[model samples]
Target: MVTAISGFEPTSLSLVAELIGTAVFAASGASAAVGKRLDLFGVVVIGTLCALGGGAVRDILIDAKPLVLTDWRYPLVAVLASLVVFRFHPALSRMRPTMLVLDAAGLALFTVVGTLKGLDYGFAVYAACIVGVLSGIGGGILRDVLVQEIPAVLREDFYAMAAVIGAIIVSVGARWESQIGHWTLMLIAIATIFVVRMVAIRYRWQAPKPNI
Candidate 1:
């Protein structure tokens, strides 16, 4: 466990987290497609965008080849998740609470992963925080845009705020603790985001909306 964390190597835990995140994001995308009454292919397209678009954008900004293109496993996981949601959306629709939990988990993981990737590409801490927030929110933003809706982060609860806090913790924590285990860092980041988001959801918390 320490070795996996120390070297920032892929571990079973991280793999599972990544898979869960991919599935949740794909479900969100597929559900949006279903709401729009789009075809199967369209559902897949949206799912791909939701599950992989943020990472792709991050990689592009970092001047690296997108991981989704290089990683067959990533796209495979995405399409399979999209298909399952497409076929079983009726049953799945009843699982809104479960979906929210999964969404929170994904949001947490994405923020950490994005921040790490940004730092890896030589970004400053503040820039990496911004990248992390963008990566956490980008996929959903794209989905909302395609569906002709306002993005949730802009108008909704503390969605982006949670990402900001988690990412900031990650950047600062790593810098403060040179020996901090990567897995430990990742876990801290995930827990921070999930706790903030869940609490916000439970309390109906909202950022102040300015009257135009």
Candidate 2:
């Protein structure tokens, strides 16, 4: 019921973003499973876990209903995404760059959605930023753990850092919500996060390692 001046409904927007992010992440998970030569059931499991894990963690932290549990559409979308990937994995596997793009898009969408949800739940900016980062990376961590791979957040790649920056952008921009519409801020945060992540990928950015 929270409607903004631009006729933007925060809850509705969040729902849409969450579903899209879920699908994107699900596809990524399915694709990964396919690459690893997992069976169909394993592909579905990984996809579902990647799609819902982050939102579930965020909801639990905020004491809100987990969308993956309460909303049927979420799991359905995830499953459908997984099935589609499984069916056409040959083409998908060939498009590694495309998958990377989708992953970045998923991260951006989830980060913004998480940060906004935190604000909706009355969290302060900094705390909400942390929640946002958690929301962005939780699913990927679960996916990686299941596949016996190191979580992207803990890797030398710039994945978690990109999410952290995106979360901060959303949280800080939210402070000026009146001056700039929340929807506008949401779009800005998503774009910023996506760009940062893509740029990092292109540049082969690496987290600093020990000099030992």
Candidate 3:
């Protein structure tokens, strides 16, 4: 059973998760910018959006100012991560496994953060679930928009599904009043999403297209 650390002060685990998530998303955004041959400024803009978009949307929905706006560290982290990836593109590109792992970690951390924030705002379970899913995919969606491409959420992978599952787990766990259950649910949700995504990639899993 996962333990609930929702009310707990920022622990090393939470901090690490946040940093890792920011880094992974930033890298992904930077990679897209590079593919588009975007200038340095464009890279920074997209990377920063990818790192903070989800959380910002979640906060707005919950009637709070975005956390990234209040804390400068988040953008600093995103920019630093983007620079590191940009500096070592050749070596970093080879670390596909590491990138995927980091992406999964980020998805999990953000999903939980979104769900918890929604609950804090006194939203019902359904609303919380929506917020959680949005928080998980919001960054990627923004990244795609900046690139003028279709969003990943509407494409072949289980991206949004993973977030939905995670949100459901978090919502259910919260209802149980068991911190352990909550955390366990969160962990499971994250793991499930990671595994599903990896497997989908490995097997070329895709959703069916509409028959026009």
Candidate 4:
């Protein structure tokens, strides 16, 4: 009796969103590696870690096989994206704004996708929300840690908060699917996360810190 929102299928929107998120995260990771002057092999390794680390960890927590292990397409997409970024990163590095935008998009998509998948696996709404946040931030954490940098989620950019809010929207929406339609709820969540993160960036918003 673990019914998810109607039409939230792996073969549909969720799958497409995950794939796109993977690509963007991979590109971001590859770009970071290139910035650090890593060789192509290191770049691809980091890209794959950034792309698959989150979903892989999520699936493991849910006691399911990671998608990257089962699906050929997932790693393939990550590698291709890394290669693309590696090839054009000089131009891309110059476009910091564009990279930030894509990073936000990936975060939003992964938040929604992870929430949906957690629900599909019969997690309670609250747990599903946590999974969503993990999915949104895990890649960046792995990427940053590998490069010996602080993870973006630990920074003062409202990054993880945005993911938390988006995950809550999706979790609540799942319960209210009849009232708001699944697709509409998901789109709203994505837009809300994107807007919140972008605005935080624009305003230099930060969570209150100890006055020490």
Top candidate (TM-score): 1
Question: Could you tell me which 10 consecutive residues in candidate 1 have the lowest summed lDDT?
Answer: 1-10
Q: Write the per-residue lDDT of candidate 2 for residues 1-212, one digit (tens) a residue.
A: 11245554467766787788888899988877887889999999999989888888999999999988887999999999999999998887788898889889899998888888888899898988888888889988898999989886797688888889888888888778878876778889899999999999999988887889
Residue 212's C-alpha lDDT in candidate 2? 94
Per-residue lDDT tens digits of candidate 1, residues 1-212? 11223444576767788888988999999998999999999999898899988888788887878889887888899999999989999999999899999999999999898998888778888988988888888888888888788887799898889999999998888775457767678788889999999999999899898889
lDDT of every model, 2 decimals: 0.87, 0.86, 0.81, 0.87
Q: Write the per-residue lDDT of candidate 3 for residues 46-122, one digit (tens) a residue.
A: 98899899899999889888989897878899998877766776788889788877887788778877887788788
CA lDDT for candidate 1: 0.87
lDDT of 3: 0.81
Q: Which residue pairs in candidate 2 collide?
A: none
User: RMSD in Å for candidate 4, one decimal?
Assistant: 2.2
The estimated TM-scores of all candidates read 0.93, 0.91, 0.89, 0.91
Best by lDDT: 4
- Pick the winner on lDDT between candidates 2 and 4: 4
Off by over 4 Å in 1: 1-10
Give the TM-score (vs. native) of candidate 1.
0.93
